[model samples]
Target: MPSLGTDPHSVRQRVEAMEKVLERMFVIPGINKPVGLDVILDIIPGIGTISAAALGSYIAWEARNLGMSKWQIARMGGNIGFDMLLGLIPWIGAIPDLFFQSNTRNLRIIKRHLDKHHPHTKTIDVQPR
Candidate 1:
């Protein structure tokens, strides 16, 4: 099995980059909310959620590598799964998917884990709002 990175900087860099791509790629006007590739890709219909879930799994996998408990990882997986399931719905799902960012939620979990377990490492600051 592969090991987690000893260097916190690399982990921070990776998680920050992914949070940007998955959650904060762009902001909505007026409300100033963040949105990312997952919502945009939903425009494609059936294949979009699948592709997005595939991309989102990377974040969960990283959480696993970082030594988060299986329950935590599973919760993260559930978040992603729920997002994908909702996204798969025809019309109603689109609006919610645009707003409910599972990736951002998962990122929060990762950050908390880092802050708790790896306190020596500076936490990555990739907030969605």
Candidate 2:
């Protein structure tokens, strides 16, 4: 893990990395679906859901630091809240939790903010051969 920095570029990188860890870290065997700490952590009942929400909230906090508008931050919070609530459902929560990628959504919001306000931090995604 890298130290969180105050610059927009570093903040963008940290947020992207955190989103990846929370929402797209691995592919489930045989099923072909990606999973991350968000879904995996949901298996532990109350703690899992809360822990995942906390991690998700950290992204929103980063967005706040980037000077994102309240509307965007609220939407990000709503995404996390919905996901957290769904994850609280014991046994069945993980099923829905797998589909509702709050962190990914939040990441999209943050990216848009950074792209619009801090254009230099924008990065291109290159596919590996």
Candidate 3:
């Protein structure tokens, strides 16, 4: 249910789901580490980083819809910028993509803001039903 002219529950769920899909979908078998389409896409040349960056923009959009401060949005953009720049490097970029997880990081920021601004509706279930 929406309150205060904001729909944090739906927004949070969608953002978190996309975060997992972008950064934590598949396991590396014996290594037991998770990697998603973002890292996989990095294997592709120019399109990978751009595609990942394009998808990452959704987090900033969600933050804007939530009425987050400009500074927060700027910080979010910086995160995406760093992720895109570093993830675009030739072969070495994949190493950072494995650890950077920008979408997850942005999700944390959104979750924090939602928790603080709307405590009553803060307990959003990120898992898809």
Residue lDDT tens for model 2, 1-129: 645679999998899899889988988888877799999899889999999999999999999988899999999999999999999998789999888899999999999888889999999966332
lDDT of each: 0.80, 0.91, 0.84
| Alpha-carbon shift of residue 107 in model 3 (angstroms) | 0.5
Better of 1 and 3 by lDDT: 3
The prediction achieving the highest lDDT against the true structure is: 2
**55-122 per-residue lDDT for model 3 (tens digits):** 99987898999999999899899989998888788667878988888888898899899899978657
Per-candidate clashes, comma-separated: 0, 0, 0
Give each prediction's root-mean-square deviation over alpha carbons: 3.8, 1.8, 3.9
Runs in model 1 with CA error above 4 Å?
Answer: 1-6, 124-129
Worst 10 residues of 2 by lDDT: 120-129
Rank by lDDT, highest first.
Answer: 2, 3, 1
Q: Report how far residue 43 has shifted in candidate 2, in Å.
A: 0.9
The TM-score-based order of candidates, best leading, equals 2, 3, 1
Q: Candidate 2: misplaced stretches above 4 Å?
A: 1-3, 126-129
Distance from true location, Cα of 71 in model 3, Å: 1.1
